[model samples]
Target: MNSKEFLNELKKYSNDLLVSMSFDQIFKEELLKLYPRKIINCHAGKLPFYRDRNILNWALINNEKEFGISVHFIDKGINTGDIILQKTYEIKDSDDYTTLLNLCHKECASLLYESLILFLEDNVKAYKQKRKKKGGGNI
Candidate 1:
């Protein structure tokens, strides 16, 4: 089903939180309004930097020394949400695209677990991204 239809169905359920991992479709403003800070997303790249698709490829292409996994509250803009947790992995000389991708997936899983714990405990203090700055250090 389409995103709108899916959302309409979702509204039938009573959920306190929404977790999205590698979900391709963008949540519309109406959905965001309905959910507010209830939605969270796990991304394979640092926010306000590698915002969208193929982040692993982009990091490799850019010759980055490290890459990160971020969990944040979902907002309207692409990955422009308040960050909840972030973790970085070093890029080794021997690492190829596949290797790096694998690493990202592994680290992402761990980060997600940790972020969820923090959220459940109400220990997570999310920070807003500075739109003026394009990039920053790894977490």
Candidate 2:
């Protein structure tokens, strides 16, 4: 079924929360209108910094000493929503893409579980990302 149709069916249920993981499609505005801040997602990146796709590859290419998993509210922008929880894992010298990805998979699962528990208990808070100033370098 299409997203709209799926959402239409979803509205029949009484649940007030939606959790998304690794969903490639964007939620339609109509769905967002109905759900608003009720939709949440877990990302394998730190967010805002690694907002778009291929985050793990980029982190490895950038030689980052650490990588992060983030759970946040789903907003219009890609991974620009308020952060609910984040945890970082150190990048060991012997780690490859596969190993790092496996680590992230585990951490992401744990973070998602904890975040959901906190959210259900009303102990979680969303923090908006602080905007950074654009560079003024001349073209």
Candidate 3:
């Protein structure tokens, strides 16, 4: 369904919170307006880094020794919202596509749960992700 129709259907629900898990497509502005920054999303890759699609494959292709999972608020720009939680993991020589995928699956579930709890308790201290600068250490 289109965003408007989907939103109309969502209005039938009683909950006030919205969380998007593995939602590959970006939401239309109509749906985004419904929750503003309150809509949270769970992304498998580190923000401002392994964003977009095929992130896992990219990581493997790059022979990355570390990976991450990020849970953040969804904004107009995909994977560019303030981060709620970001956890990194080490990749070993034995780790392959399936292994990495499974690790992310596990971490994403637990971390998303933790992030929501922190939000509910009003204890979350979200920070904007800084992209890597020409000579900067942060990204």
Candidate No. with top TM-score: 2
RMSD of each: 3.0, 3.4, 2.7
Error of 3 at 46 (Å): 1.2
Per-residue lDDT over 1-139 for candidate 2, one digit per residue giving the tens place of the 0 to 100 score: 2376787798899876888888888876787778888888998887657777777887878888988889999887777789999888888889989998888788888988998898789987889976644731111
Clashing pairs in 1: none
TM-score of 2: 0.90
lDDT (Cα, tens digit) per residue for candidate 1, span 30-136: 88988889888889987767887988888888899988888999988878899988887898889989998887778878888888888788888999976655345
Worst 10 residues of 2 by lDDT: 130-139
> Which window of 10 residues has the lowest lDDT sum in candidate 1?
130-139
- On residues 1-139, what C-alpha lDDT tens digit does candidate 3 reach at each position? 2366788998788655688887768877887777777788888787768777767777888888887889998888878899999988888999988998998888989998998899789888889988755643122
Top candidate (lDDT): 1
Candidates 1 and 2 compared: the better one by TM-score is 2
Alpha-carbon local distance difference test for all models: 0.83, 0.81, 0.81
Clashes of each: 0, 0, 0
